[model samples]
Target: MPRKRACDSCHEKKISCDGGSPRCDWCNHRNLDCTYHRASASSRKRPQPAEFSLQDEIEQRLERLESLLQGLRRTDRGDPSPPAEISDKLPSKSQPPSHGGIFYGSLYFAGCHLGDISSRNGIPIFSDEGRRWVQDRTGEAAALEGGQELSDIDLDFAQNKLSDLALLGGHNSAPPLPTKATAQRCLDIFRASTLQVVFPVVDLSTFQEIIDRAYEETTESTRAMVCVLSFVSFLSLLEPQKTAELLPDVEMYATKAQQLLLLTMAEPTIEGLQAALLLCLYLDFSGQLQAASMLHSLASRSLFMLGGHLKPKPPSGATPDDARLRHLRTLFWLCYFCDKHISLRTGQPHAIADDQCDLALCDDYTGLDFIDLKMDGPSLAQYLPKPLQPSDLGLTIIKSKVFSLLFTPSALKKSDTEILHTVRMLDEELERWRMSVPPSVRPSLSSVSDPADPSLQHEFGMLLIFVRFEYLYLLSAIHRACGRCQAWSVDGGVPNAVRSSLLLSVEASRSTLIYLKVASEMVHRESFWLVIFYPLWASVTLFCNIIYKPSARHAQSDVELVSAVPSLLKKLRARVPTPSEALHLQRLEAFIAELIHLANKAIYKHRPENPTAQDKE
Candidate 1:
């Protein structure tokens, strides 16, 4: 090594070394990732170039050639590398950058440069014009007195500039591109030599590193975005113990976000908070649910100046930045937790604000615009009351009931017999619901512009959303269940199907797992019924043997009786009638009481030894 460097990112990229500090010169220089601390507790070993031995060079060259050849072969063969690979030599880099002694490649791009090297390695070379554009940016940075360490003010200025640029780019057509013929004329040199290339702007290590650095440097206003994204990127992994270790940083960020909310632009702060939320969701996706949920809870309770909840603070000097907008959209994204928001949640729907919807803070957020809000966060609509017209209330009831049935008696589509029964019951329930809408009061079936417009037929439209979720579940289950090696026959086990090329990828356990995941829906049918159902389903697992045999545990009559409560409640609550119509809740409650008693008595009389069985859990 010529000399030791401060930041790993700088060293790793073989960029010009600057004074070793918390941030490196290159990172400070380029506003690129500059998070690496100089390795501590170890001294930089000085390199005294041992005389270049031919064998060493040969060995290195051979190794590089082998790697490149393998990659090329793989590409041609259409066999992608395993995602688990920690580091594969990028196919786009013709040669490694020279620290002191790597030949890498001597490419011709007027002369060899990073871009040239990239092109040599099969990475797409930006057009010469692109290079010119990049150089212009670098030149502008250079003129800024090599500003490496940015203050919050500097960051704001830079962010504004970038937003302006992005807006400009989005709106203006690239100052008319030179004709392809003319554009091609400038660089006829490497037209045939297809060697230079560069890797993707984001790779696993770099992406992770950006997050790591951002976390280290963030203010409260910026913390949430990083927190949410970190989690989102890491979730649903096979085993995520290592990934979850990243949570402490997120917590730190969350604290900062809270402060930002109280002290600065509430909207920007909220955006970062939203990002933090996404990180929580990713944690869930990766199977670290407890931790994800805990984070969510913290966010909801914390002072992140949540617009939906907070009484507006008096207007301050903080102006909104485009980054804030990006962050808001991002929060909307993170709120998507598998089917819900990953953001820190209060374990409740966002409370609809009591007075005027806070317009100064909020950019008109329609409930419909956030249809997926349920996935990433609470439905903003639910937090606020919808226009409580009779039609609106009726629609809400109808949709809720539809879901109760779809979720009930277990979402077991494997049995066509059960599915048909469920559908028939659903049809009858709908007819009942329709009947409740008396002929005199029912809206006319006139020329409707589009069935997709939920705002018009709000109740019926919302019901469609529930229907879609069920449909998605069904399709995904069917797809997963199609694994020939794991196909379900009448026996409820995998049966062989004619193997197809894609059959190897079918995930049999996926459908079963989905059913298992939403299993509580089968019992209590609340949105969170799955949380309760998990324990019950797990009871059928070997781990449950610590207490009782799975077969015996699941077979208990009490379990069946309890599971029925959700559906019964769903049936009762889903069809909320107007106060005028008088939903005799007392009668419904009494019926439930009778059912529970019968179920309990049946359970009390149940004998495990009896061969006859009627329990349908």
Candidate 2:
């Protein structure tokens, strides 16, 4: 899909967009990056109709201003810029309505329905109704199935007290409250409750039904239904071509939604929360970070992260702040996810898969097969957890079960069965955790630590990372067994010593970087600088050989860097080989470069004969 703003190349040029993808036409032919960003001022200018050009928009505005100037020249003529005339002609929208108030630029005003709640009936209206509705209907809605119980909690005023917030670096923006440390850190929350409302859309035919409903809803029930439906409706509206058309309305409603959520923050339920969550999701898709600040605030809490594992008790005598805790946890996970996205974008602070990586590794052939990985049977078994059927169970309490997989899983069967086994066990363990906890308790759970605990989102993250390594290892081992310098498989490939050399390099770079990062953490900062320099130097060697040479070839530079490609292939032949049902050697990421340089340096430079030389000290 075409991205927001412009192509990467256009962004670097610091110019406006004709809004093309792949690369703007100008940059495409020139062979440049194409990741354009939106300028804040661009929004103030009205979106020109499809046929109208940006240049035309500016000219139109200018012409109007020029006409006003001429009228002023007549001295007695009326004021220009018909805002005053429009204001007069417009009916008084000046209803003395008491707005819920604005926090973070959102305008919070509840109109019409509150039903009996607005009149203050005994039936726990307002927050209660919304929460109940969300709990009651979420699962039946397409894309929102797997809904759990309503988890409204009494506000934890003592814990959420201003003093408490300050100690924890409370929401700075809120007092004005607070934050983005990772994954698309900026939240672009908005309310799509109106413009794009529709019934749940698992398919296409119903999609239009939703849009029609949003435009036609006259009552609260239908409006509520429309709100839920619009959550999906907006996804369609977000297509690249249609995005510009809806951007203004989406922005406005997003602002409105944020205001509504913030103003009604006390005991908010699934409807408002989901609205906020969907808005954040939409903003993320559209790359709208600035206006989505409310997401950062709500998601920062602990509830959203841990609530999936929690279950709520009856309405009367439960913990008051549990729901809020759940809300925060969800935000935390989403933010953390985006954090990784940002980190990858920068391509800095790289981490090679460590020993903790998921099973599926067979170090013998990391390069030629799975990538750069080493799989061991016992290691693959570690992550396996007993499968638990889906339900609300405390993922934190299942520590022992988590440990079960840590010990070699006899049940492990696949060649790289350990990862699969671990996941099976985790299924139950995760379910157990999900079933026991209530949403309100998520924040408290965040403080708890258990390797098996569902609260430790890292457990899952680490699992995925491990899986990547396992595959890398498997791929490399196959390459080594078959023959180096071939694709994954070639009917009669034979192991080439030179090809193995390159494979070894990929491994060495990563292993050493990990060792270095760990080692540096252990030493005095000043002394550690020396250790850090080696990894950098090693990385430079690889870069000079691979990345720099490749770039030079593309740039037609004097360095003649492309010359190194042959050596790289030769080195690859000596390092590892592909061996199996046929063979092949897919490409590798830059981290592999570091591995090769470090491996070759440690092996060939200091002790050329020690082909299997390892850093044992």
> How do the residues 116-155 of candidate 2 rate in per-residue lDDT, one tens digit apiece?
1111001112122222222221211111111111112112
Q: Which regions of candidate 1 are displaced past 4 Å?
A: 1-271, 282-291, 301-327, 333-617
- Return the TM-score for candidate 1, rounded to 2 decimals: 0.24
331-375: candidate 1 lDDT, tens digit per residue: 322232221221111112221211323222234322223233223
Best by lDDT: 1
Q: For residue 99, give model 2's deviation from the true position in Å.
A: 42
User: What C-alpha lDDT, on a 0 to 100 scale, does residue 30 get in candidate 1?
Assistant: 46
